[model samples]
Target chain A: MMMQRRLTTLFALALLSFVAVASSPPSSRVVADSVYAIPMLTLRDQQGQLFDFASLRGKPRLVGMFYGSCQMACPLEIEYLKHLQRVVAAGSGKSISVLLVSFDPARDDLAMLRKVAGEHHVWPPAFRLARTERGDEGMLAGVLGIAYRQLPGGGFSHNVRVSLLDAQGRIVAATDASGRPAPAFLRSVDEALKNP
Target chain B: MISRQLALIPMLMLPFAGKAADYVPIPAGQFESALAIAGHAAKLRLAAFSMRSEPVTNAEFLVFVRQHPEWQRGQVPSLLAGANYLRQWQRPLEPGESVLPDQPVTQVSWFAARAYCGSEQARLPNWYEWEYVGAADATRADARRDPVRNQDLLSAIEGTSGHLPGVIGTRPANVYGVRDLNRLLWEWTGDYAAMFPNPDARVPGSVANLALCSGSALAFADKNQYALMMRVAALSALRPADTAPRVGFRCVREPKRK
Candidate 1:
């Protein structure tokens, strides 16, 4: 009788565990379902390190796209992002990660990426300069709402837009990252960090 | 009995052989594009590539959805497609009686179209490539100079509304032997986002501010090409996840080396 009772208890515990596992959402599903989440892509950073994009899921980030050869807007974009990071850190006491991906993968090789990173003084783990191995860079651009076209003179005409993603990779704020950081966007970042 | 079974083998293999999509080679060339950069007409130097002879059909998309159920109507993530995506289909896996097999598939999002192209070992053509091929007519490779031809294209676009898309290849092929570049659905390009004239500039005084210093805005070299202008306007208005009743796509690939 005791053996049968113990068997019944074991079965109930197994069923409870199965339900728990089934009910909770998987980490991949959470990332895949978010509208602002970057797709499962493997990219190489300026340091020639291969990292899955999803690895940045657990931190709030400011993401944008630019090319290394961009003479004017790209350099300013990096400066603006750095400025925003400083402001967010100073105001909220939280450091936001920055990721600037390259749309011109063919021209922006590792050396070029490294050169730009060094010029901008962007260090990894806080700021990352990266490019994809293939043509999916356009898809990333589309999701971030950045527009770019290659010009006849081998330059690019691209809009500058920056997006802020929460720890789970959900877009909390986005704005034109052309000049000084918009105060409204900074407030959104502050709110995002405060809640967590 | 064994000889009779052997005779049926060729018949069984026929459908599979016919399932492959046909691609035509577009020769490499320096072509002038309608969209301008830095206030001048952009000249594109294209490499040799092969393009699908026709837009993807409803039947073909059905096969893709079956193999990739994640792309099916209800199954697809909202990030990849809006609520209206494939809403006209009878079911997730079936195009149904209302949707014909040969009709060019519409109501597909850009992400979905890109995935379909990827599955075929191809990718969506960039806007420049699409515009380059679109400049052709049945006779001349570059026919944008002909006002009558341009007028006909405008009429075709005006007439396509409130109507289901006709079958692909029903129209005459372009000079490059590709069909349905016009007079059909508005197709998605790989670089649709890149074609925006000045999306950021629309932010009201933002352009005059620091944002405008980036030189991101584009200008049209030939504003007289109303047809191309209208297409660019329509495509620019869409987000990657948004789907339309008339928007569809075809794939392109680099020509195979001998």
Candidate 2:
């Protein structure tokens, strides 16, 4: 029985090493300070494909949170991001990616994500609207300095603080996405994209 | 071999893992929060939920870190917790001699607090839920109106000032059978930051107002509820990743679907 157990343990070790070898190495070890060091947060985008938040580590991205049913501020947020994208592309000839995760996961399902994306004329890959498929959405919100509270009537009271992450997922700059992107914020985005 | 040892951690933690019934049910009710926006006191409705009777103790959190190593002091990313995260503990896994096992754990960030609660299949109580529970004294629910009781609470908070909080359950549970709701430590409500104390948030078209859609500026319903107001102000001043020497948290669970 002892010998049988030994063989089983040996088999497990071999399998573990094999699996480790099969997985792709991170571009670089995620530093303890980086937000990407957050446990693997799997997000389902508007296209309904599951992608890990860590996958965006090697590039600069604009990250924020919004709810699908938000009548005013959320739509304005999308527009502002699009405007930022256009301005950045026009000036720097580089397109920065965007990720907007939902605050209301119960209501912001696959259909809601898709519907919101369609209405804003935003699409995935370059721009994505997503819901947390697994992991703590509040942790992400907290990291990004976003605060939200659900009101009595099912509406959310939230802030539109969008953060600009460097290639390492360190927040380099942030701005209230309620209006046109601040010039200082635009400068940081330009700077991050250049370094990336 | 390492994996085998790690797998035994659950069994090791069995002794420290308190009963699941540690959570006491808080009945549903409506109450006017001290802080409402635009001088309007919005009567908020709360759903019946279960809450941890006592604040999480240091010994219990030590076991939690042993199981989820990523949440340990040095292992936690800076984005999720401040540099002062778990500073009182001698080591990542040891609360040490200076810290008592049953003493409430403090120096925790909101993110860390949320993650700790999440491990128990629970979440941090919302501000309203917290306030609702905090309203109780030994005999009566909604004891905020009693001048003597409020003075006693204020004294208790001031007494613990400049020192670590004492062990949980030193006093009897309130009417809801929950101990140390707002007495020992300033607990992290899930939506602590959602309370906008800034007057600018009330302005209809201001940048702050725009950022906070459907948001109203918070106003205090009663100036006499100084203790609760102090907590709101202190909590609002902290960033999510920021940790404090006096801040700790407890968990709450929604009722099971029939």
The residue-by-residue lDDT of candidate 2 on B126-202, one tens digit each, is: 98888889999889989988999888888888777647888787798999999987678898999987777343332
Which 10-residue span in candidate 2 chain B carries the lowest summed lDDT? Answer: B202-211
Distance from true position, residue A73, model 2, in Å?
1.2
**Model 1 agreement with the true structure over A68-164: per-residue lDDT tens digits:** 9987778888988889899999997888888989988988999999999999899887899999974477667767767777766787767777788
Runs in model 2 with CA error above 4 Å? A1-26, B1-21, B197-218
lDDT of 1 by residue, B1-258 (tens): 999999999755532343678899999999998877657787779888999988888888888988888788988877788898988799898678788777789899998999899889999998888888989999998999999988988999888764678777678999899999877889999877666445343353432232221223235788678788767767766788998878899999989989
The per-model DockQ list reads: 0.42, 0.31
Question: Can you give the lDDT of residue A90 in candidate 1?
Answer: 91
Which residue pairs overlap in candidate 1's backbone? none
lDDT of 2 by residue, A135-194 (tens): 988888878877788877788877777889999888898877755677888899899988
Q: What's the distance in Å from true for residue B213, model 2?
A: 22
